[model samples]
Target chain A: MIRAHGYAAQNAKSPLVPFTFERRDPGDHDVVIEILYCGICHSDIHQVRNEWGNSTYPMVPGHEIVGRVSARGKGVTKFREGDLVGVGCFVDSCRECGSCKEGEEQFCTGGATFTYNGTERDGKTPTFGGYSSVLVTNEDYVLRVPEGLDLAAVAPLLCAGITTYSPLRRWKASQGQRVGVVGLGGLGHMGVKFAASFGCEVTVISTSARKEADARRLGASHFLVSTDPSAMAKAMGSFDFILDTVSASHDINALLGLLRRDGTLVLVGAPDKPLEIAAMGLIFGRKTIAGSLIGGIRETQEMLDYCGEKGIVSDVEVIPMQQVDAAYDRTVKGDVRYRFSIDMKSLST
Target chain B: MIRAHGYAAQNAKSPLVPFTFERRDPGDHDVVIEILYCGICHSDIHQVRNEWGNSTYPMVPGHEIVGRVSARGKGVTKFREGDLVGVGCFVDSCRECGSCKEGEEQFCTGGATFTYNGTERDGKTPTFGGYSSVLVTNEDYVLRVPEGLDLAAVAPLLCAGITTYSPLRRWKASQGQRVGVVGLGGLGHMGVKFAASFGCEVTVISTSARKEADARRLGASHFLVSTDPSAMAKAMGSFDFILDTVSASHDINALLGLLRRDGTLVLVGAPDKPLEIAAMGLIFGRKTIAGSLIGGIRETQEMLDYCGEKGIVSDVEVIPMQQVDAAYDRTVKGDVRYRFSIDMKSLST
Candidate 1:
């Protein structure tokens, strides 16, 4: 067994604190990663607080993990010592399910083994996430981090980045298309980058007019203040696609109104409350409202490659491991410019 | 001007009563049709009662009309006297819009001239629907009714049939797919027939167990009682496409769970309230909830052709024009077998 030290929440209401745990010894098909960075995701907060009602504790919650491969078991031929790799939301999923076979393991029928706050395939062993100093995972689940990108900034790509990328790709957002990214937070920022990099005319739709300059700086060609009724009315039925990234409850019908005929609004954010959608909005324009999770392994690697090629990395605020609780609060308040990545070296200090 | 007589709702609170009106004489591009039958739609009730808040007084409500060409203007080359034809939800649309040019005139950017209770393109003349003795329509908006089908039964095809068929066709429902149809009304019944005729393994999902035998008689191979928890549990993640036709509000989330990964739930019914949807359901499975209005004129023609070839027609209860009020009440209580087609001859009587 490998000794692992990380932050954990003893219960739903408790703040995370230092804790010690063990990971299984590297199996024949497994590789051990010395964690370098872990990006905090909104889901981590949801799980830690048991907001979803399915959480278990003490839970070490992190999934957007970036690290250096420290050891490889004999049968692991994919990576050797010191290779930079990433682990996203899930660590393992049943390989035989249709979704798994189709490379969409996020929808695995047997239930995916979440990186944290979830059980392994055996249904008895608890899994710890990448707030830890090390992780043991099968080579198949490991993604090769492309060269020449800031690793800390790349950590959130596993979650926020892929969550936005998968939908853009699926919806065929491309050159000459008008794309709108709703919200200007972690997920929306990446959406703008991806859509802009794809040669689309990107527009940032937000409640705050303050984000206009920042959105333009992030490669958006237009910014529409969603709170402005006249602006919204002028932009109605204009977008080919709208990537909605707001996690807070908002008016989805108004967003649906922004789509042209046959246009789509893809929801990447999981709002706690159910959305109120008028069928007429969709029916009149023949519009669609779809949702997507983080991409599959192959797609995640593709996203990383695309980001590397486009020089696109998350706009992140790096912090020490001790500041995660504060960062979580800040994230809830939308104070962070984008994402927060915990530098794992802070654990040693 | 041509004299016409039929049932009209004098005001929102009133029932249909005999009313006289006049239609413009056939112009160069027009074909005048003597009405044979008109199918009652649930929307007719909504419009008559001002449920949508857009109703006009003295409204002649019906769109599903099948009749014979009574006269053709000089420039009307598509039809001659005695030719069987049908007119659906709309009578005219701006021909220059993208939707109109693509034959999706129903979504005309300049606003489609609905068969009834809508203003014509000139923006002042009120258009009447098929409940009357005769209708004058442009050749472009008329459809050829194929030979050998019951014209009265085919009346419902103009509205209810096209409403359901468009979504099924758009979703690419075909052989080897599992299709589920919700409810057993005018729209749901058509959805089952279309999906089943498309060589799919069809399942009828309904709240009533009594619908099982009727659903099978409509060519469905499987019937699942939606009210049965165990049945719903067993059928979860089972369908590739579910054509939801329940206009009255119900649990959309539960129906969304019945689709497999990448599956879609298409809504043709317009529930009065906005549907409540959990984003996680759509995100985790890559599922979609989409709305479709009636198909384009081209597609509607194709649907009619397909129905003719397959000998498919709505299972309808024929009634006199005076029984429309009773039919509406029965339709509301789910007492009708599928649809109510009023014989226009009774209007003259």
Candidate 2:
């Protein structure tokens, strides 16, 4: 067993506090990583507060993980000491499932083992996440972090980045195509950067007029205030695709109207309530509403390489490990520029 | 003007009554037809009773039409005198829009002229559907009713047939694929036939256990009662595509669960209220919920040709024009075996 230390919430209503735990001994295919940075995903808050109802207590919540390979078991061939890598929302999946065989481990039929607040395949061993000082993961689940990108900024790519990139790529967002990014938060910001870098005409649709400048700064070519009916009506049936990254409950039907015939509205954010969708909005135009999670490992690696080539990185606010509780509150208030990356080095203090 | 007689609903509360109307004389690009059979659609009842809240008074509701060309203007080359033809849903469309240019005239940006309860391109002339004794349509919008098929039984093919066929073709529901058909009604029955003939493993998912035998007779290899929790649970993630033909508001999430990874649930029927869909159901497996209206003219013709080759025609109960009112009530009660086709010749009596 390897001794590890990190912050954990003892219960649903409690703030995270420093705690000590033990990680499993490295197996033949395992690589031990020294955690470098961990990004705060909205899901972390949801799980910490038991908002999803299935959260386990004494949970160390973080999935947007980036680290250096500190050690590797004898059978691990993918990495050596000091190689930068990442572990996203999941750490293990049943490789025999159709989804896993196809390299889409995120949709594993046997249920992928989430980074935290979830049990291992044995159904007894609890898995701790990247909020800790070290992580032991199978080489198959590890992703090679591309060189020349800010390691801290790259952390969120494990979650927010791939969540947006997968849909854009799947839907074939490309040059001359009009793409709309709904909201300007963690996921939306990445959607804008990716869509723009892909040579698409990008528009940011948001209820906040104040996000216009920030959205433009993030590569959006146009800004449409969703609250303004005239603006929404004017842009109706103009977009080829719309990436809906808003996690808060909102009207999807209005967004459905902005897509042209055969267009799609891809949802990446997980809202608590079900969406209200008018059949006519989709039927008349033969439109689609689809959902995507963090991409497959192969696609995630492609996203990282693409980001490295395009010099695209998430706009993030770096915070000390001790300030995570404050960061969570601020995140709830939408104060972060885009994402919050915890400087794991502060854990040593 | 050509005098035509048919049944029309004068108001939302009124029953269909005998009424007289006029159709325009054949234009240079037009073909005039003597109506033979017109199939009763669920929408016909909805429109007559103003259930959709968009019905126009004195509306002649019918779109599933089969007829014989009585005359063709000088410039009409597609059909000649005595040629069997059919028209569905729309009489004309603005051929300039992107959807129209792509042969998806059903989604015409300038709005396709509906067969009834809608105005023509001029935005003033009311277009009467096949409920009348005669119809004048442009050559482009008319379809050739393939030989060796019962014309009366082919009426429903215009609406219900294309509505189901379009999605199956678009989604590539073909050989070796597992396709599920929800609701064993007009559209569902066609979906079963099309999918089965396309060489897919077809399953009929319905609330009633009694539909099992009928579904099997319609070429379904399997029948799963949707109302049975154990059956639904066992069939989870079992389908590649599900053609949802249910017009009534039902749980879309449950149907979504039956689809495999990257699967789709295509909705052809328009429910009155918005549907409730959980984002997790779609996001986790990269599933899609899409909508499809009736096919465009080109595809409709293709469907007709395909059906001709397969020796396929809708299972319909022929009725006199006077029985339309009673038929509408029976349709609402789900009492029809499959479809009701009105014999337009009864109008003259």
How many clashes in each structure? Answer: 0, 0
The DockQ figures for the candidates are: 0.86, 0.91
| Candidate 1 lDDT, B22-136, residue by residue in tens | 9999999999999999999999999999998999989999999999999999999888899999999999999999999999999999999999999999998998888899999
Clash pairs, candidate 1, are none
Deviation in angstroms for A62 in model 2? 1.3
Give per-model CA RMSD.
1.3, 1.2
Off by over 4 Å in 1: none
The CAPRI class of candidate 2 is high
Question: Which candidate has the highest DockQ of all?
Answer: 2
Fnat, model 1, is 0.84
Give the Å error, residue B118, model 1. Answer: 0.8
* Candidate 2 chain B minimal-lDDT segment of 10 residues: B50-59
Model 2 clashing residue pairs (backbone): none
